[model samples]
Target chain A: MFRTISNPWISLASRLILAAVFIYASIDKIAHPDLFAEVVHNYRILPIATENLFAMALPWIELGTGVLLLLGLLTRSAALLSAFMLIVFIAAIGAGLWRGIDITCGCFTVSSEGRQLGWLTLLEDVALLLPSFQLLLTAHPGISLDRRYLPASPLSAEPR
Target chain B: MKDWVAAHRGKATIAGAVLIVCVFGSIGLLRNAVAEHPLAWVAKPPVLVKYDRAVRPSPDALQTVTLEDAAGMAFDAGALFVDARTAEEYAAGHIQGAVNLPTNHYDDELPAVAARLEGMTLIVYCDGGACEASLQVARRLLKSGYAPVVVFTGGWPEWQGAGYPTEAGGTPSP
Candidate 1:
């Protein structure tokens, strides 16, 4: 049921979109680390100590994964990681809505976006999930280094 | 083991090992770096239970003032009027000489406010009628040691109805 994008142009487009999302997200968080930390705390998910650590590490993870994905380096690993992080975000947004907590999502906006714990945020995350899933499915597609660096044929059969 | 090592000797294995090391090491180092910066979007400093409880302003601390009371005062030269509404709401219209200090996230912004209005009689208000932002802000200010914080319960709407001096798109007149 999934559309496969084996074409080089399609693959490039997908990679670019994913990379742009990550890069933009990372820069925004990097600018206002403390506010992002508060957003994490508002989720009421992690312990206070770990919240800061996660906040710090997550954006850099995004940045690293984005760069790696853009370069088609370890495409599968990067896509999988991005997908997993998106899932966690969806869950957090869902829980926040269910609990009726009016909190500003530090997702995109630098300042408070007025605590819209609604379906919109959840839907936006789901939309992001689609591209990630696409990348994951076509993890080692022809255009990637996975296909270039690692030969398609078995290495063991090659004569020394 | 010797045969396996000899057969597997290639650039592929080295590249794979290097990639793994780099990814894992980068993750560790990134975690350490983030722990130091503590970005607000990702995580926030813990809200101490004691401080949270202590900081919550008492309801009675806010003194609700009537329009007449506000009008009667001979504009105490040192009195500072604060509009505890959103900037948009304040911009649409507000009591003349009132500064905007929206109540949402007041805890984060109050310290800066306290610094500015030190030793000034602060009058806080929101929209007329049942608006609580003014009272909430007034209580918070009182908690922060702002003396004589008066809440104009009859807010901007009332001030406008009384034909009081009003301004738009600029700082209010004293």
Candidate 2:
């Protein structure tokens, strides 16, 4: 079970999938901080003062995490952060659903006309958690920048 | 714990990711600083309530009123309080005498209430703290030719908290 789970191919697939998700999610948000800030405000979870700062900072975090994951540098930590972010997203969406507040998800796009917050969004976040956990648990350094920097070990000594 | 950390190469990996995050975060902040309109760090609800008995704000401008303004408007003869909350929320509890014109259903609902809104000042509000429905509805009202539309930023929660008049159970028919 451990060998199958730790397969280099599985690690690579998980890393690539998460990288695409995060990068695609970050673009529009990075372009329009104002719209993103409004979306963040609608959540009503964070304090008013922190909303703008959070809006400004979050997309960059996503972009950086995505780029790092794509390169497979700091793969385990990037996956760890991805897992953390997914949990936060699930919690925020859960809170919004509980409040029955009519709001856009602001997951992919910050536009007012974007996807409405719903149970499906909660499911999507939970689904993304699978790959994040996979990478976190077994990040293979082979075929990644980590191959050179990370100390060679059983994870890196792939039988090619 | 130490072995677990070693197996995952946690120390260096965590450090690298943190460094990347910090660098990118600083870049984002700097970019926002130089942008055309930097977002407000702290939200301060407008003090339109203070305008009452003082100089009325320009008719053309969208005014954000405080709870006091909404309460005062509740009794004012020409002023009409409009609730932008959902019908369910409106039915649950709302400011006394406020008409429901929920922002979500603005298009479908506006026509039903248009005749009643003619020649009246509209004071719009929602659930309060961080709720945007009031502002949205107020904008729609202004566009629909309702002049002197004021947003009660401190909305139902503030009004109810202040021991102001309230109504519940059944939303009045349009």
Candidate 3:
């Protein structure tokens, strides 16, 4: 549904939720860098050196995008980035499942002890994708900093 | 209806769709290109260290080792058999030659056990399939540079079933 948002509050709430998810996920991974690296390794994706780099950098990217989304600054850009990340995650999980490699998804945690990539992980990613897509499709909410710093209409336009 | 057509007709939905396709398609292509390289991020196995160094024999290591073949290998004359179960279980019964290594405290006391069984084949075992202490103990032995670590994967269950010589209580006589 591409219909424009008539209610800005709904849009703002959704943006917050999306941002919170990204920020929360990033913090957990940051806390356990080594374990996260192992999880990334379990995916069997990426060169050895690159896996370490990704394990170090990807969480920050997620955190940055999330903060932007929460602030509603460049909302569309943040949503797009989040969507791209989620899509990549889903694809990786799907590939792991297809190959029958039992490993942790590492989206949430880096530990391989109890985690397993399966249908449920894919579903969670898809759920995150929906809210991100919604933010992308709707206009920036009026309550956001985007509205404050860069109003949709020209600054000279008569105040509503 | 007429007003709607007039407003929407020039929006060029097809061009928009094509632009979306091109962007996503290019991204997909780029991803594929990176993935195709053997050195791509996803191509390598994760690095990890093994806790044990017994060097698990590869499937192709010997091709096959039948009971007769196993028997043919020189048994270490002075090697001691170490049972890694609890004392109570050890008291109930155990392999005739096995001394209690009791893996529950295996980590802390392995050195002492090893010293007693110095220059001996430390065959380690636990209850059975569900037991991991045997493997843990075996790993410890290997780490300590104990030679020729043999793990009876089937452990006590197999030993008892095979009707091998067994004994009860404190350290059976050699």
TM-score of every model versus the real structure: 0.57, 0.66, 0.50
Prediction 3 TM-score vs. true = 0.50
At residue A30, give the lDDT of candidate 1: 63
lDDT of 3 by residue, B1-174 (tens): 434423442232223323333454344334334442212334233222222334564321211122222222225465566777776688899877677776435555566555667776566777766455566466557657776565655677876876766788765665
Residue B57 CA displacement from its true place in model 2, Å: 5.1
Winner of 1 and 3 under DockQ: 1
Per residue, candidate 2 scores C-alpha lDDT tens digits across A1-160 of 7678788888888888899999999998988787688788888899888888899988989988898888877777778788888999999999999999879898988755478899999999999999888776663644777776654432222221
Chain B TM-score against the true chain B, each candidate: 0.60, 0.65, 0.55
Error of 1 at A83 (Å): 0.8
Docking quality band of candidate 3, CAPRI definitions: incorrect
Off by over 4 Å in 3: A4-6, A153-160, B1-174
Task: Please give the TM-score that candidate 2 achieves against the real structure.
Answer: 0.66
10 residues in a row with least lDDT, candidate 3 chain A: A151-160
Across A35-120, the per-residue lDDT of candidate 1 in tens digits comes to 56656766788877677667666776777777776876766556666677789889999998888776667776545535456889
In the order shown, the chain A TM-scores of the predictions are 0.82, 0.92, 0.86
Tens-digit lDDT track for model 2 on B26-131?
8888888898877666654433333343566654446777776677777878888888887878899887777888764677789877877888888888888877
- Pitting candidate 1 against candidate 3, the one with the higher TM-score is 1
Candidate 2 chain A lDDT trough over 10 residues, lowest sum: A151-160
For candidate 3, the per-residue lDDT at B105 reads 53
The interface root mean square deviation of candidate 2 comes to 4.9
